[model samples]
Target chain A: MNHRIGWLIAGLVLALAGASQFLLNDYYQRVLSVIAINIILAVSLNLTNGISGDFSLGHAAFMAIGAYTSAVLTLPVRMKAIVLPDLPVWLGQLEVPFVFALVLGALLAALIAALVGTPVLRLRGHYLSVATLGLMVIVQVVALNWQPVTRGARGINGLPPFTTPLWAYGAMLLTVGIIWRVVHSPLGRAMIAVREDELGAACRGVRVFRTRLAAFIIGAAFASIAGGLWAHLITAITPASFSFLLTFNVVAMVVIGGMGSISGSVAGAVLLTLLPELLRRVETSLALGGQPLYGLSQVVIALLMLGVMIFRPGGLFGREELPAVLARFQRRRSAQRQAPHPSPSS
Target chain B: MFTPTYLAQQLINALNLGSLYALVAIGLTMVYGILRLINFAHGDMMTLGAYLALAGISALVLPAWAALVLPMLVIALVGVLIERLAYRPLRGAPEVAMLITSLAVSSLIQNGATMLLTAQPRPLRVPSALTQRIAFGDLSIAVMDLGIIALAAVLMVALGVFVKRTTIGIAMRACSENLRAAQLMGVDVNRVIVVAFAISAGLAGAAGVLWSSKFGLVDPFMGFVPGLKAFVAAVIGGIGSIPGAMLGGYLLGFAEVFFVAFAPPELSGYRDAFVFALLLIVLLVRPAGLLGRGEVNRA
Candidate 1:
């Protein structure tokens, strides 16, 4: 009936879902973990694209930073001591627990945000997009070339696979809750005001630059956590995985899931991630041959984008908050039923 | 290999790459000047143009000379169709919508290429006249590379004259400055924008052909790098300024070659990253770009 009740319901559903994940086979459980990881990424990115009203292509840079940092920190020191005996135990034996590693990763990513945001925050539109995109490219390039640190283009393999469905989904819920709270907070409202019209917001005493930076840092931190989970889940990391195409996929999810809606972000992350997997299965079953069904995924994504842009420019749930959109619509339908038009005395 | 001849070869390499970027950036500036949209799909359109040209070469075995002329015509028409469909609907929407729409269109085209033709890279064969190289003292050069620079230069001058000396170009310029006032004076804003995309795309197609010719490979993803480089060039040159894009393209080309020459091999993949960093620096120093006009808010 109210926000409290709605949130309670969402929490219950998530808890039940997390419990059920343990019952799943490794393959199906991994899929759930993937979905959870994407949920964090999609929702965090939305804070910038949807709320801060900035389109950042460089999120992968933050994701990479988090993933690599966590992988390096969480790996066993005794193992590295044997392999590279000269290196310090601190660098090698990151024997911290998984959650601590995630937080450390997020902190390091946020520090990077503070450093880069100075120059990057100045740009708007294409300039900003290009700069952020450049950041991503630069990160990938560094990851590939920074051989001593990143193991070069061969990628940093042997990451601990601690990313169970429980951890992944729990992090998603926690991260989403934090972001959703921020989105409705005073700071979030200020960010929205700035987005609606920077000049007007400035006139009204909004610190546009500061608010934007705050949003950027927070979003980066959350994305970092997601990236850490992803690195652990796969047990390997590659620069190629964080390419522009990957950024585009995240952006498409945000756009498709109704950019401004938290529920839409979850829906989008789940649906698009599953859609391709489903399609691949079907194609496999049908024994489709030739080029491995090249570009089918992109085509589906493109068509869906076209349809959403043309027919539902506001996205599936529009700019409306999810709880508001779904709950309000349901309430209206129920109200209509209860008040069903006066039947003539029968 | 590290002799004068080697230096000359690298210079030529840079020039060829830079020339294609300049041509595409020049087209980008025209559309940006006329309508502030960055035309994200411009690069993908170049990919489509290359594909179209490949079809031409495969079907009729057009001489390289004929291809240089023919692909431009076909791509110009395709460009006009893109304007009519995707851009026309969003003329009055926010800049973000148009930008996003261009991205959508680009994805559609890229995937459509995959669906229509195999996603595999193909070698487009050209006539013998185009591939022939001439000896220039210590350095030899591909005729196609020289042709690309020459054609791009000629088109630049032609475009400059069109924007400055022609009534339609003047109308287009006027509309870009103040759409409402230009409409009051009877400028067909829609037609001018459509024309801008068409001409911009035509130049992009010609550049695409040269790009494919020089690289010896063409694929769906080929457009991504060049498109981004040209966008960098546009930003470097000043997004809304034609001469600015040309200058930026040359500088970018020269910079990439020299950066590769000086930097360690491992850092070479960062050529674009270097340009992007410059873009960031340039934006910080001059947000409007080197050639761009000061921000003028619409009344």
Candidate 2:
């Protein structure tokens, strides 16, 4: 839990990621990258949706902005000219290093979040949710109709796959670290207070609006980074790739892991990412009336989520981190060992 | 460009569209009013209705009228079943948990449909009589459109009478106003909830059939967009108010039709975006909607 231990664990993770590049096969490496990106997305989304309780449904839009920005910026100039002929000359000609493009994309996403969050963060409950969903649809509409810049529905492809396990895992660590810091800071406590009771938080001198806006902007920035990583990992980008389904998947991760828990997000990201992959094999082998059982994984996952909601609505961790849970288990066990066994009462 | 005949034709189109939206939105508002839960699966219910109607006509060889009736009944039951199985247990849980559960239900239904039906678009065969057009001097309208409008109006009027005049309807209104007070007054909360879901799903079923007929296609995911738009309509009218939902639906339908009709052709693709923007604007200016009472946050 100390700073030194945190740095050591981060170093170990990066070293493992570096080792995976050499040890793991291409397919496994790709999966690892996807898992890392999903972790970044889930953790960032949890900052707003879970920790701050803002419940944004437009995370995908920010991701799309990041993806598109990074894709356009890093697309070889020749390819940009061919794919996006009508792009502004400055935009069409410019190409940046992968990290710089990703950063720029994140910044752009953060700027848009600030712009949209100003008015939108004023609303509460379902109204806020629908307003955010509207923002998502508007963003998608632009991406779809702005053919010159986005290449219409065809999307962009054949980009260099700059997202390795190292890059993805490193970014994931950074996102988790930043969010972890934010959640533990005074501002994070303010966010929690606002979430519990906006009026009460205001009465307690917490700047409710600023706290929420901060969470929203920071979450959007990290989501954009995840988007950029996703685009580069796949070496292809499409507007459709950043649709509600992606948001739903991320939301599922946050919910299943435990809302308001950082380690829960990591666990949820890993479990959900691997679940479908494992189910994909099951689906292929299963058949009904000689037809392959496609979409089975989705049905199962949805059912699992429903079951979780019904049985354990707090999710797997229920607002507790992995270490906290383990530590509690250890304490309980020690206490049990010290207690005298009771004989049957008369 | 603004000729009377063209305007009349557009008005008819708007009316037809508005009726469908109102039908869907009414159901959504009814559920939200009583439960305060945004049933994300409502749209999928519409899809299921369409598919059921398709099956009734094509697979069962039922007449078109029979097809519509059967689906409505079946979907009504399905709605009640879902309320009991999925929603009842989470009664006192957090709003977000219920929301997530609805999302899960929606995904389950959509994926289940996809798994069983193969996700392909199926054509819903309509009798030729409904497709025939009637002309009034300069303007012409399809019989199906007329039928849809009349059917929707009758259903709404029936619903109004049921809610205002009937004991159960009054019970529903009581529950929506204050569920705890209604229960304290000896209202059968379960019965009222079941009736609300049945009515909502039945309306959605009818709307689904009409919507699919209008578009001439049925698919697993077809209901999502219309369902979402209907929710917007419900919001615009002021959620939890029936008449408000109807009004909002008509307004949305008219806005959409006119926006496309008047805007440049290149701007047509952004019609959905325009609708959502209108939603955002409405939420900002009148969060309680045109008819909804302002929500008071009780400490």
Candidate 3:
């Protein structure tokens, strides 16, 4: 690893980023917060997609899982009390706070993943993709009909407000940090090996199912945290909000940032999140003739996804990072600063 | 709790829904078997087929036969065009790329329709001749629904004969079984794929008319749900199998309608839920789907 100075620099960059969110207005801050959540989603998705090479479109399904789980758990017993009038006074005032809800949301999503991923993971290619997609549709269908739990499609609104820019970015950083550790771990290496070639990976003694399952559940867990954060930040929840479009957006971000690169995921998330608002602003300032209109953001997103897929399947950064990347930089710096270190030592 | 009339009504609904699913799924299964890609834009193809049918019908009320025939022709051509323009170029690319491209094409079609044909929903015209209902005892079925069932059956038969007995059909089957082997045998693989798309589009075109007439409304986005279900049907039946696609569609339709009919009203909204839950269970139990051949178990 690089010396503490590189770590210090990374920390400083994140700190400066955190402090700037406070400077922005509340709405802008909230948008930035959403970006942070997407960062978690895109990066977590990369764990399965970029590194493991699975087109798991049902990722937003996990987001829905997280959101609904957190919504049920995090919404004050008081809010539920007034909404239901079921005579449980202690439950109404008993808010479980934001962080706890996020953890529960991640756990719920992971639990569902374990259940769904087991058999479905046996299928591969578009079969696996479609099956996972079916998993999502099933979850949505359950959420829509399980009125006692999810409030059906009328949606579960009025979640506690806990996702500020600081909290969201903080969660974002923690998610990225943890995922980075996971990816650098031995398990992450095996997952990548399977992705490169399943037959070869199996021959080399990798447990294909376990590796795939770990990636699947972990991705679900982080996605749920993002969902929890999103639920609270918006303070309003609906199945419609976490529809296929959300999935498309997150996939787009991961692709744009570079599939396997954590840095790329963050870049993609921030760019895509800020892009709609920026485009909406630009669309307002400019116009086709004089009529006020919107939703071209979808057009841009669709085009970008198509363009990226067609032009650059390897994504922006092309998957090479973290294996002596820090050491390479340190070697260069030490050579410059000390001026006596042997270049051959590397 | 089952009455003759109620059973009859559900059967008629199932037939109507099943035929539409058949139309959409046949094409899907053909491509899945041959190319091994799920054209996510397939739903949009159905939408495009309906719109084209609507456009043809809009100019002047043609006789029912002419209306159905001409629209199918137009949509079949459109399907071939899509293959040439989009699917062919991305032929050897990863399935994910093709999937995303299909999505792009889908958004392009929907929004393009919104821009060109007016964003508002339009009523699709059903010929008065075909709109009448035939009654048997207390049970009644619309002519359009009956016609759709009959037509789908005929097409399915015709398709089976064409694919099995004819030279092109045999070639298509050969290509689907082994692309490399068929290529070595001098089959024009590209031509076969285009034909597959054309057939798919034609089926969708026919289904489009029935779909619109039954629903009494037409919009650019109409294909989304049906397309999805047809894909589901394809998966259920077994991707790449013609009979599987049709059978899957009927099973799903019956399952959905039955759930809606029997389940509690609050749970009625779960018709799709039950359908998908059934799909997941199917995935767990029979990962190749009910009739699909299993391959690549460890991805």
Query: Roughly what TM-score does model 2 have, to 2 decimal places?
Result: 0.97
Worst 10 residues of 2 chain A by lDDT: A337-346
Best by DockQ: 2
**Each prediction's TM-score versus the true structure:** 0.92, 0.97, 0.90
Provide a comma-separated list of chain B TM-scores, one per candidate. Answer: 0.93, 0.98, 0.95
DockQ preference between candidates 1 and 3, better one = 3
Q: Which candidate wins on TM-score?
A: 2
Candidate 1 lDDT, tens digit per residue, B181-284?
99899998888887888888898998888788777677887787688779889888777777888888998898888899778887787776787777767766
Pick out the ten consecutive residues of candidate 3 chain A with the lowest summed lDDT.
Answer: A83-92
Ordered list by lDDT, greatest first: 2, 1, 3
TM-score of chain B taken alone, candidate 2: 0.98
How accurate locally is residue A29 in candidate 2, as Cα lDDT from 0 to 100? 100
Backbone clashes (count) for model 3: 3
Chain A: TM-score in each model: 0.90, 0.95, 0.86
Residue-level lDDT tens digits of model 2 in B1-299: 88999998889889999999999999999998888888788888889999998888788898888988888999999999999989999988878777788878888888898888888899987988889999999788999999999999999999999999999999999999989999999999999999999999999989998999888999988887788889899989989999999999999999999898989999999999999888877766776788987672322
lDDT per residue (tens digit) for residues A1-346 in model 2 = 5789889999999999999999999999999999999999999999988988888777899889989888889999988877788999999889899999889989998898887777667766655566666778788888999988888788888887999999999999999999999999999999999888889998999888789999999999999999999999998877778776788788899999999999999999999999999999877788777767788988887888888888998889988887799999987777667765633431
